[model samples]
Target: MTQSLSPLKSFSPDSGQVKVWIRRLVWKMSIATFLLMAIGSATRVMNAGLACPDWPLCYGQFVPTQQMNLQVFLEWFHRLDAALIGMSAIALVGLSVWFRNVLPRWLPWASGFALFLIVFQGILGGLTVTELLRFDIVTAHLGTALFFFVTLLTIGACLSDFQGNNTANKLPWIGLTAASLIYLQSLLGGLVASQWALHQCFFRGDMCIVMNTHIIGVVPAALATLAAIVISWRTAALHPLIRTFANIALVLISSQILIGVATFKLHLQVAPLTVTHQAVGAALLGSLTLLTVFALRDRQSSGQYPASKLT
Candidate 1:
């Protein structure tokens, strides 16, 4: 039998209860999406992206019993996780519509857009295999996955208990800048991984530019992240969550930098380290997103965005 939500035993039909339920559901999906990305990264690092050699199936079957191995398992399970998350996204939209009166008007629309991103992500995922894991296709696949992850986080934050304040009007913008820079850096890193840039640059002395660009991109991203943390620390009476997020971002970025350096030094030969680098990067981005979205809500509730108000 299919399991219900964790809190279903005590679930109430009230609108407040529904809001909490949906918010918790979104956060759970967000965590699942995060793991899916990590699994995708592991698939790439393990050179298992094309293990099945088909879309939506392994060896043209639901499960390739004869071909099951580490590589096939990674690819197959990656698709499985993606499929489940896609289904959850559909449920999210359905629940938003089913409870439209009680839920925020934008929840349905935002969930729908997230579904759109996941659809696009699925297309990219297929292209990665059909097109022989071309660097651009692979990079776009990672980028779309990250975007979908961000969409979920945004939804969860909007439904969160985070309250707004007037103490820091500019923190939101700063957080956005940092988040955007980090996202671009991630795409660049994806390219570097997809093309095997580090290995090429280290051994064959080719593709140095791609690897170098990723290394150089870190400077701006790190500086922006640090700026957000410093500014948030100085903002008096900032929402406790805001400060917590900023601090988490700082720690994540620091860990990401160290992981990146280690991955590079090891020439990307260490699959676990390589995967950890990507996972840490995702976590860092998530932290920045939480900070930015909460800060944006603060600005909105404080009447900073008069024309475009959030519910």
Candidate 2:
């Protein structure tokens, strides 16, 4: 006769279920990171980065009572959201370690890297405030945040269950190239905003060289984005959801370009438009990232298909 099954063995979820939960958690974290980016862009546009004038606390407390204002609220809430993401990142690392036996081979390493990045991101945030928003530090801070967001996006894609027919599509490389170009442009954009170069160029027309650099950067970025969309559409094996995201990248980048033109034309006078442009830029980056990830996953499936299927 067989021995009775152990309680722990009997109650534990199957490998598939554990993977599903991990994927869901990663997706949630990605969404939180996306929203955090939007809030961050808004905070910068509002000129409220120093609303708290302190790190890990506002007005030397968990919350600021004496300095409560709209700017303070925006800054405080941004920090709060970041802290939440940090806690979630740590939790993710913990869960991945605990369930390393059940997770995919790559997830644990990625999770650990994410944890490190978030810790670094928190330190950068502090430096942005404490150092009085030096242009280089602020640019680095934004760069770190974007990197963190991209990490979560990758983790989410790895844990995703979306699958379609795997095909020999060469579009994945194109997507990767496009995404990288866009990311470079994003860093430049961040620099433009942080250094007040955009305002200087738009209003005073003094910093034309930097503005011209940004303008030239947009051409390659747009071309790459267009190629990614077109290539995605041509690749029949790509999942429908991935195609949808590629289409979204096209839309967002288009809107971003238009808004960017408007921002310059209007001399950065319209606050909402400028802020929306920044948010849309981030969204564009995210969509392209997802598209690239899904495409790569499909490519992998075309080879020796793993037991753990994408769909």
Candidate 3:
């Protein structure tokens, strides 16, 4: 987000300053969440989800230096990242509420909802261990993290300064649809990983349904994302910003497909490729989301959509 939300411009300079600070925190947390998801993926693939064997601690100690190894370190660092963000969420909410008089009224509520997701995500993370990495719980953990990531992006986009042209009509909705499909595809991908569906289908001829579902899922998500890029590129006078994000989404989804193919060919044995698959999926989703929010903001600010739609 390059600028403070337009409505907040009416407030005093101090309020603008406050918005800037909160926006920075949202961005920082967003980056951390992205890395946290990557680390979580690594933990799962490395069989480190259960390395701690306890909630919020490893072997009843904060550091667990004596037990620290690669698996333990992955799992431990993952939790540390989550815990830091959990606390930072509290501060985010506090700032939103404390500055509500001048900031957008919805900021505090949005922050609250994000905090709720993080709390639920924390619980799901615990269940992944106590439930012994049950496929369902693990899938939910990844899903919630993606959901939280989207929320942060939405908030950040709303606070951003945006510029758009007449060609933006319907692009926001298009990007949103693509983003939704991509999110579902990502969850499907998560399921495939959590259940070891690919490995099962390849070796034991089991869990083929899950693996196939993920394979079939690539169609809608890829088509929708490609549609956005094609429409943006073909449109005359579309904002460069939207074009840039669409291009990024295209690269990410394309890379994801290639990486998915490579990972399948390798049967998930290549840890780097497997991890990149998930990370790129997250990045693709983020690109689509930011594109949608920017379009929404652009239209709303330009009077095509009601202010309530975005600001």
Return the clash pairs for model 1, or none. none
Give per-residue CA lDDT, model 2, range 1-311, as digits (tens).
13466765677776788887777777787788878878888888889999888888998998887889989999999999989888988888888888888888888889999999989988989999989989888888888888888888888887876544686277778878888888888888888888888778766877678667878999999998999898878876456777888889988988999999999888777878888887888788888888888888787774333333332
Task: Encode model 1's per-residue lDDT on 181-296: one tens digit a residue.
Answer: 99999999999989988888888999999999999999999999999999999997677778888999989999999988888888888889999999999999999998999888
Between candidates 2 and 3, the one scoring higher on lDDT is: 3
Q: How do the predictions measure up, each by TM-score?
A: 0.92, 0.92, 0.92
TM-score of 1: 0.92
TM for candidate 2 is 0.92
Candidate 2 overall Cα lDDT vs. reference?
0.82
Compute the lDDT for candidate 3. 0.89
Q: List residue ranges in candidate 3 displaced over 4 A.
A: 1-13, 303-311
Clash tally, candidates in order: 0, 0, 0
